[model samples]
Target: MVDIAKVTTELLLEETKTSGHSPLKFICNDGYLYYCKYLVDFDPNEINCLAYEIVSHYLLKVLNIPTPDIALVKISEGTLDKSKIIKNRRLCVNHICFGSKGIDPSEELTEFETCSSKRDYNRILNQEDVVKIALFDLWINNVDRGRFINPGFNYNLLTVRSGNKRKILAFDHAFVFGGVEQIGVFNSKMPFINQDKFHDSDFYKSFISYMDEEEIIKIVENFIPLLKISHKEVIDAAIYQLPDIWKLTPNLANRIQEYLFCEERIEKVKTVILNSKSIY
Candidate 1:
């Protein structure tokens, strides 16, 4: 199980601040930086969101996608005032922020800016070195309700520099399409064969070239254990803190289990991801 004690409001405050419409931050904790979103109180919707983020991150990691380090952590007692709570909620996804050294290659990187803006989109394209970030979103099903306009990118555009060179890093799997049932349909405007034109674009091709299928498979395999361990820890902590409130309903629990453990479905996803050359 993940150590819930490691996720505290004080730690969140110290490591980072809120961005977008939510009270979440890209902060650092326990040696890794994450994009943490805080919820003042818990609700079914919020719980689902938190669950999605954690599970999606795990799945993406398993799929060998370049996602950021992620986890769900609860704020300790009294860290936030009851009055300060936006909706009488508790629990949050403690997302680690990237580009702590401020070497992010995305031209649009900013402090405390919401990702759901056209201006931000323009900035992301300019600053983010990679041309295929949009493709990354499509690959992971990050689209929310078929509305691709607001696909989250704060964590996606992060880059690390090493000796006069910058490397592209991808993270943030919380918003993947399957997480929210409202947007899980595989609606491709074009068929698979014609998808090559989209993939051939300089931006798309370059990023695809950089990622080899075998490498991604290995990364995904390595991440499963880490995710399993983290989920057990988070769930155990949740049960301890709010036993009655956080207990997963039998149906919800089954859904979560299926999402996490169904190997055949995951393998199919892998096959699609590996064989598809187009981003659409």
Candidate 2:
């Protein structure tokens, strides 16, 4: 859990652009770049996707996976101008947002797909990071990376080569627990929720190929304890990260509570972890 209150940075809207609910790059008052996400408009589900981004970012950090540094940021009308608006509304101005510190600009970074296509394993360094991310995705039921529709193109995987050290990083986690597009189906935890997508898609299959049974079980051992977090804790963590002005009706907050922190939700996460046996 990214349970701590983050240092707030005002969005420098001039350098930012329109983006969806997922993490996007923005310049802030500190003269630094951050990959951030926020709740700008009202969605039917009332689930703030930024909650998942912050949660997963910290979780990955727990496993020693190098994720971006996460924080709570602020945006205001004074800082946000016309360029930052999406759908005719300002993007989270006067609201708290979720953000991850940008990877140092001087580091030599490349997207995973492009690097993989170029056989840049020398730069990718550790294959185990790949295993950790794959198993973590299974545990969280993240569909973003290895989607059936977009095979071989993993979003949010970056390879950084800095001086003599090489590393792999996992960034986006907004789709964990299948929270974004198909909340009900993923929340239900039906057996093999996207069976065809994970099985038939080359993207997910490639992740499986990198794993051995030993690593999968090791991750399972570490992952379950984190789920022991209570409903109140999860709700509080998410709420603490949001701006006051960002809308949060009781109904939506309640639904988010049920979907993320309830006992049933924990059980569903366990179910996904158990099913991951087939992944290796």
Candidate with maximal lDDT: 2
The C-alpha TM-scores of every prediction are 0.47, 0.67
Q: List runs of model 2 lying over 4 Å from the truth.
A: 1-24, 39-47, 84-88, 106-119, 148-152, 183-241, 247-280
The digit string of per-residue lDDT tens for model 1 on 33-56 reads: 333453333234434444445544
**Residue range 59-168, candidate 2, lDDT tens digits:** 57666777767677666466555564454243545566677777764342222233333244344576556655655565556776655343344355665677665776
| lDDT score for candidate 2 against the true structure | 0.55
Superposed model 1: Cα runs more than 4 Å off: 1-5, 11-21, 26-35, 39-43, 58-141, 144-147, 150-157, 182-206, 209-244, 247-249, 257-271, 278-280
